[model samples]
Every structure is written in C-alpha cells, then in structure tokens.
Target: MKAINPKTKTNWEAIGVKPHIEIPQTNALDVAYKMALNEVKKSVSDEHQIKDINDKLEELSNSLPLKEK
Candidate 1:
C-alpha cells in the first residue's frame, strides 16, 4: 500500500480554514485609552485641567516598564 503525504494533499478549505480574515496587531485597550485621552484633551480648555491631565499621563507612563528591543 502506498502512503499519502498529508502536507502535500491536505484540503485546508475542507477543514474550514479561512485566509481572508485580518487580525489587528494593536491592543484594543491601548486604542481605547488613546481615544479617551484625545477626547479629554479636546474638551479641557482650562490650564489647570490640562496640567492635571498631563501630570496623570506622565505618572501612568512612568509606572509602566519599558519594553526591550
């Protein structure tokens, strides 16, 4: 009996394989956080409010560890 090679004869579609789907690389939390930050910056016109926002952003950024290359 001859053995069939699975790699060369596999029907990907028959197994419900999908190649058209695109996955996002960015974290959803990061995207939502940036959107919220932008909206906050746009709505705050007072110097103190802007300063407070900047301070909070700086504090949060400093709290996270840097990613190594």
Candidate 2:
C-alpha cells in the first residue's frame, strides 16, 4: 500500500512505519457509524436552538433604543 502526505510529500516508509493494516470487523464498524450519525443529529438540534436564541436577542435589541449620545 502507498501512503503519501500531500502537504509534505512524505511516504510511510520514509517515516519508518507500515501503512497497511487489517480491516475492521463489519459489525463493529456499523455500530461506530450509527453512533457517529446520532451525535451529528444531536449537534444539528443544538444548532437550531442556538439560532433561535440569537434571533430573539436581535429582536429584543432592535426593540430597545440606545440613549442619545
């Protein structure tokens, strides 16, 4: 297997390392993928809540006027 770092143009052999390894079991990989997907979904929900808070803050700021300078 060929391993190259694009930025540094270095090979794994040059770094004194082996790049190829055994593949992961299918069941373990599937479970990890599912967990990652759930985390991403939770993140998206949190982002929506943040956006709502920001919108409310902007509305409140617009409603209140600053004292004349």
Candidate 3:
C-alpha cells in the first residue's frame, strides 16, 4: 500500500501565487510618519520589504506640494 502526499505535486508552477502583482498604496501624516516607519522596520525580519519602504521615503522627500514662482 503506497500513499502519496497531496502537497507534493508533480506540477507546482500552477499552485503558487499569481504573477504580476500590484502593490498597495500607503498614507502618512507627514515626514514623522516616514521616520517612524523606518524605525519600526529595523525589527522586521524581511529585508526586501524594508528596502521598498526606504525607496518610498526617498520618493516622498523628492515630491513637493507647494510650488515657487
């Protein structure tokens, strides 16, 4: 009597998450929020996500709401 594991599929490509995913939008009160996010990221386990967050901060810093004539 031989038993097969359902998790061990012959074709795994079709079981994983979908490709071409879209990221969610985030809102912050001000630069303080970005700073807080950075601080919190130090404790997280993921590094790639942290880098994405840091890049987001850079974008926010570059954007300006007020314009000069």
lDDT for each residue of candidate 3 in 42-64, tens digit (9 for 90 to 100): 88678898888788867766663
lDDT of each: 0.58, 0.52, 0.58
For each candidate in turn, the TM-score is: 0.41, 0.30, 0.41
Q: Write the per-residue lDDT of candidate 2 for residues 1-69, one digit (tens) a residue.
A: 677889878786746654243234544444444445545555565777657655654554454333112
Among residues 3 or more apart in sequence or in different chains, the pairs in candidate 1 whose N, CA or C atoms overlap within 3 Å are none
Tens-digit lDDT track of model 1 for 1-69: 544448876454445545342224344344445447768998899999999878776654554343213
Clashing pairs in 3: none
Select the stronger candidate by TM-score from 1 and 3. 1
Consecutive 10-residue window with the lowest summed lDDT within model 2? 60-69
Rank ordering of all candidates by TM-score, starting from the highest: 1, 3, 2
Model 1 stretches with alpha carbons more than 4 Å out: 1-35, 66-69
The alpha-carbon RMSD values of the candidates against the true structure, listed in the order shown, are 11.6, 17.5, 12.8
Candidate 3: residue 2 lDDT (0-100): 38
Error of 2 at 10 (Å): 78
